[model samples]
Target: MSGDDILELENFLPYRLNRLADAVSRRFAKTYRDLNGLTRPEWRTFATLGQYGSMTASGIGAHSTMHKTKVSRAVAALERRKWLTRTPDPVDRRIEHLRLTKAGIAAYREMVPLARGFETDLLGHLDEQTRRAIVQGLAALEQAADVD
Candidate 1:
């Protein structure tokens, strides 16, 4: 194949972005994983609930950009661990609001500082100029794509 015709996967924007996201997530995952044995989905769900106080499965899935199945499984796992509870809405029997229990809250609180520190460490690798440029570039891309 000619040099111009060859597709370099690593240099592709989407592929690069996806790879970077995965790598960052994996690095961050180690922190929460050690904190309370939380998988990515569980951590997302827990963090969502922790941030929002209470939310439905669909809400958590949408907010966290996780698949419904993953959200359901995380919910089940958290429930099994007595970290969260589901309550049927007063008027809507089909909808359940998920909230973290006191134990879950404690766990979430503990993870917060660790999560913040991890982010600080990640950003610390980049100089201020590069970090600002990256943030601006990502924001521009998101705006161009009309991402919500």
Candidate 2:
């Protein structure tokens, strides 16, 4: 097939979404990275635990769409920083439940406002209607893709 008949990745929905997500993530990463020297996986794991209270490494990986190795490294990093603790599950000796420490909670609280500001700054560039439309369109697309 001719190049003209081939799909353009730049214009593809999946590619566009991935590109947008990476750009947004990098923009937001600066806040946590500068404040706490956290990497993307570490930040994601920390945020997931902060939001969800306690969960297993597998749960965090699933929730954040991260790989097992990434989750493991993040967990280890946070543990070394005294920001998270792991407790052996009573019913399952092989499973460990992870939770944020007091320090982690404090960090999470400090980062919340920064995260909100970052989101506000980005969304503020768009008009109210456009922002609403973007939100609604994203929801529709997620539903269409059968993503939770």
Candidate 3:
């Protein structure tokens, strides 16, 4: 093989991780599109709002692993749909606190079972122990990357 064509698993982590993430996203989008017609960012926004109840845009950004600008855009889209409502933080007018609207909550409730099934199918090959280990390892990698 040419030097340029050499393959090594250790050196391919980033490529593999990106490809896996993309594939999972594509599969999920295909699987869940009919149920809710949710885009990735829209689903992410709903998830963050549902879990945390209420949070500023920066908080959602951190939880969603998305940029502040992306979060802002998503929030705007959700607001336009009336799926979520944003209020100016009383304590800090500059920050907008977001909450899921009743519509958002109902939509989320309806989608939960489908989402769970999608996740379950995605991890069907792995046993619980292996799945936990993989999750822990990925969390460790994310933490390590955050360090200087």
Q: For residues 40-134, could you state the per-residue lDDT of candidate 2 as single tens digits? A: 99999999998999999999989998999999999999999999999999999999999999999999999999999999999999999999999
Winning candidate number (lDDT): 2
For candidate 1, the lDDT comes to: 0.94
Candidate 1's residue-wise lDDT over 11-108, tens digit each?
A: 99999999999999999999888868889999999999999999999999888888999999999999999999999999999999999999999988
Rank by TM-score, highest first: 2, 1, 3
- Clash statistics: count for each candidate: 0, 0, 0
- Residue 27's C-alpha lDDT in candidate 1? 91
Q: Candidate 3, after superposition: displacement of residue 11 in Å?
A: 5.4
Measured against the true structure, the TM-scores of the candidates, in listed sequence, are: 0.94, 0.96, 0.81
lDDT of 3 by residue, 1-148 (tens): 8978888765698888888888888888875467666677777888889888998888887887888778878888888878899889788899988999999888778777888998898788899999999999989988988822
Q: Residue 68 in candidate 1 has what lDDT?
A: 96
lDDT accuracy of residue 53 in candidate 3: 91
TM-score of 1: 0.94
Best by TM-score: 2
Q: Supply the global lDDT for candidate 2.
A: 0.96
